[model samples]
Target: MSKLSPGEVERLKNSLKEKGYKLTPQRRAIVDIIIRNEGSHLTTEELYDLVKKDCPEIGLATVYRTIQLLEDLGVICKLDLDDGCGRYELVHQEENHQHHHLICKNCGKVLEVQADLLEGLENEIESKYDFKITNHSLKFYGICSECKNIKNK
Candidate 1:
């Protein structure tokens, strides 16, 4: 697993301080896990399991609270892919490159659409509707190639 860089860690710590939140060990551990697994889109339970390996004393309630706090602080993003559980990924502070998701309806596999597919749409919306597009998420649901092949077989 990748580790958080010193600069990234400090940035997160500073953000917590600005919000009147102390960087406790448990909170740091959770943040570390999230940053390390940057694109994993981990759920609360998934995070809890990974965090437990480092700090077995940490409780699920604590993880949930920490996740909520991080989300509130804009340190992490909450994603709902219609998977009946909230998934999370670190907020990319540097770039505005927000990727969309393609979900397989039959097998529930999530593939990341890496391109900024809505730039034109956002520009049009802003121009026509007088709205500012700060951020957006789009999910396309369909059968993946593997699932389609299975049906053909």
Candidate 2:
């Protein structure tokens, strides 16, 4: 899925309610920013900064707590984008599937791509060891074009 649709958000809220988790304002704001910054791979601190722009009264403690709760509810996925920041993104129901991020070491930029391209390895693992694949993360580290040109001088 591209991002959480209005229907998806309402469905998520209802699901969370069923699981005994309420979608309070704090949680809503936190999730909204995560969805807006879909591919940005934002850390909780970064998320808090974004939220504070709209809800100045939101505390970092609350952001932290809400992030954990939302994560537990499967509305988003926590990512260690290999940039020293634990980031997150909304779990888009229509998207291909969860994937890993590629980080530009010199620029600290993040790019998300599908993990399906690794089917060869996935099959190898299953065939060789009967490991029945479920999921995995693969991060690549490199200097992006801009950084490469800057350092070439």
Q: Write the per-residue lDDT of candidate 1 for residues 58-90, one digit (tens) a residue.
A: 999999999999999887889999989899987
Clashing pairs in 1: none
* lDDT score of residue 99 within candidate 1: 72
lDDT accuracy of residue 149 in candidate 1: 98
Q: Where does model 1 exceed 4 Å of error?
A: 1-3
Give all TM-scores, in the order shown. 0.89, 0.86
lDDT of 2 by residue, 66-150 (tens): 8887788778888876556788887766644577677798778777766458879888999999898766778888878788888
Show the lowest summed lDDT stretch of 10 residues, model 2: 92-101
Model 2, position 75: C-alpha lDDT score: 81
Alpha-carbon local distance difference test for all models: 0.88, 0.81
Question: Where does candidate 2 clash, by residue pair?
Answer: 1-94, 1-95
